[model samples]
Target chain A: MKLKELAHSRTGDKGNISNVSLIVYHLEDYERLRQAVTAERVKNHFKDIVKGEVIRYELPKMGAMNFVMQEALGGGVTRSLSLDRHGKSLSSYLLEMEISLES
Target chain B: MKAIRIGGGAGYAGDRIEPALDLMEKGNLDYIIFECLAERTIALAQKEKQKNPSKGYNPLLEYRMEKVLPLCVSKGCKVITNMGAANPVGAARAVKEMALKMGLQNLKIAAVTGDDVFLNIEQYLDSTIMETGKPLRERYPDIISANAYIGAEGIARALKEGAHIIITGRASDPSLTVAPLIHEFGWEWTDYERLGQATAAGHLLECGAQVTGGYFAEPGYKDVPELWNAGFPISEFSENGDFTVSKLDEAGGLISKATVKEQLLYEIHDPENYLTPDVVADFSQATVEEISANNIIIKGISGKQKSSYYKTSVGYQDGYIVEAEISYGGSGCMNRARLAEEIVRKRIAYTDLSYEELQTDFIGTSSLYGEQTSTNLIPEVRLRVAARCEERKEAMAIGQEVEALYTNGPAGGGGVRVHVEEVISIASILIPEANVRVDVVFEEL
Candidate 1:
């Protein structure tokens, strides 16, 4: 199943740093999210574009995780030639990640 | 005690005004705030001010004031904004003039100035840019605006001085909302916990309708109730830093846990170290409680003392940018857009004109996500070629060459359009907070 089935994400960009927050629909799904959406997985998933380190911060109480990607955005919003300078659609793109359930 | 209601009237400079006006008219708001100014806008406004002394404020100030101020005055709802842009004093005078024209009596407007540090850019000449690490002197020749993000004290002082409308320059976006909390609850400026809580509340409301549903909706999985008339966000804040975020009754938007959580993390780099001039807010320990439909209570937000340094957004002229686009349609149009993009690149290369940055992407396809996302070809796509060049001639060629694509081949091209804009790039730097002094002056009709 895609991560979109369990969570929604939001992306924001400042300078070259891109931050994406992944929030699950249910508290029961947080452990699975924590295990699936690891920083290494996210970094490897977007390895071609993300040239810097990927750091994830957990908000277990809120059932959300924030991934901060440094040196992304191709030199930030103002300098980046990308059409979507603000990275508004990155969350939707990240939602395409495949999650395997150990049932 | 009942909490005071404050509404976010405007988010960006050109944000929709009708929803905010609706909030003011029917929501029974004690105050309304507009967080309109950003980093590069101040630089652009500085250029405008240089041309005409009274033209430095946000361009939409007149229209917004005309639509909301009269009713806000009649309803006894005070207004606050950073629409002052490059000139808070000028903006205040303009607001006062508008009130007088509207025949509103005793409308007190205060402009909080002293954010502009253009003359003192010389002192920070050797200071390095926080992001690029380039020395401030490297951008000095082209530097246009240098303003420090101030705290809420100036706004609180204005309210203390009986200001009905408070205008400020380069204040933190959250400061617009947090200032009202300070004035209403009489909280000490040093109260980090309370200030942090209010700052969090402000951040939640600063983007107007975003927290309500405007930016939270998806067609199926995560849906919002009413999007067309998405209601701007309002907060009922109490003295103890407890608040309920709601909107006007029967407004078209959903205020659920999901929406609030999305907004909570909006632009937040770190939940524990959200820095502002007033305080370093920590939202990790905060809890969001949905009291009812469209009424979400947020509490337990805390923060540490503010740092001694103030963050400054230094805007400089980064040359010019040109974007030109032409679409391809009908069968195999995707191939045509790509072919057109290739032609554009060859033309730019043939001209022997170098650019600071150049990119040619096929729109209606994978423009930003690159080829990684868009694996299939579409029926129609637009070829967009853009360049950042130091010289106007080079920038002009970026579009001119694209226009020539119509005659140069890649058939079925239409809707050819080109745009050339002067670029203003911003750099962040930290300066001694003590040097940035905020003073308020009153302008009354």
Candidate 2:
């Protein structure tokens, strides 16, 4: 799977918290990943789980991707455990998704 | 709108006073903290304490503080530091000279002391031992410098006294800023949760943005930018002990989980029982995130109980050491370096002299050529021999004998430059928490 396609497949579950970011090791591969995974495709990946919109942000220098999956969880921060106890659940939730480099 | 609380650049290792000053000038910072101590510094402090009661202070600290304190006063930015190596009084006095130079009258400089145990060494050593719960035997005062690592309250007191620069003795590195939080917010010391948060914040930045990719940085060293002049870390602790770690600007440096993770492991082995004079912080209880550019928000640094003892740094005159580099110039010049090490090792071993640390390195002849006297003929090799012994007499004896190797040994060595033998002691001291205290006093020049 292409790294970008892999990124798309992994970010499917996050609902409205559409922005998914990655710290990529390879520079050219990051560019390829960015080019393959467009904002619409990223939103489409999370279409089933997300309730609202999906926005993607890129930090080109650091090879990082930020995905804003809207309504990813049930409610906003007040109703969520996003900031509690070092955000372990969030890290765990994020860790579950896997991505592979493009052939 | 709330009063703007922005000022001072962070993580400045060298004498680069511009970044922090520029930030203070532009951002209007409320505080400026500087860290400039390393492993060798402790040894230097021990040397000073031997010379005078207030000799633990670093002269560089005074030079730096002299520059910053006046600026802080002019801009109302308070300063705190652990520059009080041995003599807080002397450190304060040095700053007072700076204040006088700046013509800043009414510089209320509050000096925090009493952390030193040099005078009371015999008393503590005789009274009790933590391990055996008995008196330290014979109490042969081998101590060079003994000081308790103090917290930030003393700086808080000095701040309260309206002193601009709070010079302290050996203090928890984080306590420099933590005291300010407590003082400004009127937070109690027993506010363990908040204190823990503050301490963790200090730890994260105490080494100046090691948490944000200054040291122990992963990935390629190329991408890390502005590292030559990287900014220090500034933390904002909330009432609930939740804080954000950020630098002065959107400077380039990694602040992701990896960067934060590496820093979290620095000087910390047990996440559960991270000890400081102020509090024992649990890194496990906290979560970290690369929230934004050059910003790492550290949350939920929780600890149920505070620590019982403050980690103390004590040093004594371990001994003297000398090093001499002699070139192997004779027929077997190439092999002389190797021959020299073996000769020194044999002599010391034969004499049954116990040295603390001794090492010999062969220079000029590249080891890339492979170890042992390379048959790939080289012009000459420099046998650089260095050794440290517990006793000066013993170290000197060993030094006197190394020169004899050329005459007695198998040959090919000459041009020996015997470096001067100076009095050096391996100084180490640690004082318990109960003994050390910190106080800050602001004085006018």
Candidate 3:
């Protein structure tokens, strides 16, 4: 399954950090999913948009990973959490990455 | 088969050695486990590893081991720990050297690695996306760390090999205990229900005495004895998948339903679906009641079939970051931080500068938002703002703007302390067990 569909939504703060708490039915698949995506690769993929710093944290036990795309959130404390003027969540945008591995 | 005995240990850092040692001594336990990783702690470990790869793995772990391992070795006990950070092999070698120094050459120590999948990061990025079935490069690039949180089986293998000490880099918290059980019981991988119960026991004791009144202790704190040093949780598992959670007698902490409940809730999501490599355990069927002082028996935990994946805890060197705490003074002490955040945001917008992340904090201020829709008070707020970005220049720009806000904003320059920034882009990855395999070999002293 895709991260967006599994996690529902994601949130990225000014630090280029994105967090999505999710549930995976099969516990065995946790590690495979993690190996498929990496923080550096995630940052490099968005190197243009996420020009500052990029970090990722994984809670394998919980089957979750958090990506911190530093400075990607428009100076952080001043910008809005909403995706647009209509206050749409940015989780969908963040989950747009089509990544998979041998899970 | 004989009942399996397991204990889980965790501390604020690595200073809780006395109680840990005491518990081993008093309980005459078979296995002792410890967990010592947080986000910041991982970052710190990574830095230390970069400087001296041999000197990471939570500094306190080596010190504590130096103090207790000899005694543990003399008593013919085994220890399994995740103290092996970026340098599991290095840490294991250190222990071997320590053993040599003590003239105890029979220490048959083993270190389990290969779970760190960082080497395969490029492969992952270059692979296809699961949902869209598109090439990964078509979407994202540059992943940080990719590691597998191997199950207890690796540690169990070390135990089976007759190693008195085992060091691993990132195994599940509950896996510590499950490893011993798997080693002892000769359980099959497909026996998910049995492994699930073992995992539950480890989870209960993973936080040490936290399940026994460390963090969640209340008014009974004064009455509790041996406050100076407390005992971690140990379990006695039977072949039937039943286990009792308890601590050594005369130890400082108290084990009861309240304490166990607190630790159960620690780092958990749905109680109904507590996930593990072996099986998904449902805490709903479990009950914690005080069997005696510093002891709570865990009963009736049902387990389901195992999952297909092993959780991966991969970390990578994304870039460097600097943190500075700017104090806001007087009525708007918090506002000063907020205003600084605003200024930095505006400045970054104007510049081509970008940061991986930046974080700011108002040290002494309110941390909560109003619970109700409209609750009124002359609220005193302190903004603890921080951000992480990839571009060091952007981070510097954000830092400069935050500092500049103090010159013209409320309570100008009351106090500011810039915390050192380091490479903070270690990320976690999840992979299927079928994809990554565990390899173990015996090493002589």
**Model-by-model DockQ, in order:** 0.68, 0.02, 0.03
Please give the CA lDDT of all the candidate structures.
0.87, 0.58, 0.60
Q: Residue B157 CA error for candidate 1 (Å)?
A: 0.6
State model 3's lDDT: 0.60
Docking class of 2: incorrect
Whichever of 2 and 3 has more TM-score, that candidate is 3
| After superposition, candidate 3 runs with Cα above 4 Å error | A1-103, B11-15, B38-56, B126-141, B218-228, B317-322, B329-383, B405-407, B426-429
Reported per model, the fraction of native interface contacts reproduced equals 0.49, 0.00, 0.00
Query: What TM-score against the true chain A does chain A of each candidate get?
Result: 0.96, 0.58, 0.63
| Docking level for model 1 | medium
Model 3, range B22-110, lDDT digits (tens) per residue? 77777777787777654335545655776886776768766878876876776666887878765677778888888778777677777
Q: lDDT score of model 1?
A: 0.87
Deviation (Å) of B103 in candidate 1:
1.3
Each prediction's number of clashing residue pairs = 0, 53, 81
Model 1 residue A15 CA deviation (Å) reads: 2.2
Second chain alone, TM-score for each candidate:
0.97, 0.78, 0.83
Query: Looking at model 3 chain B, which ten-residue stretch has the lowest summed lDDT?
Result: B367-376
Instruction: Identify the leading candidate in terms of DockQ.
Output: 1
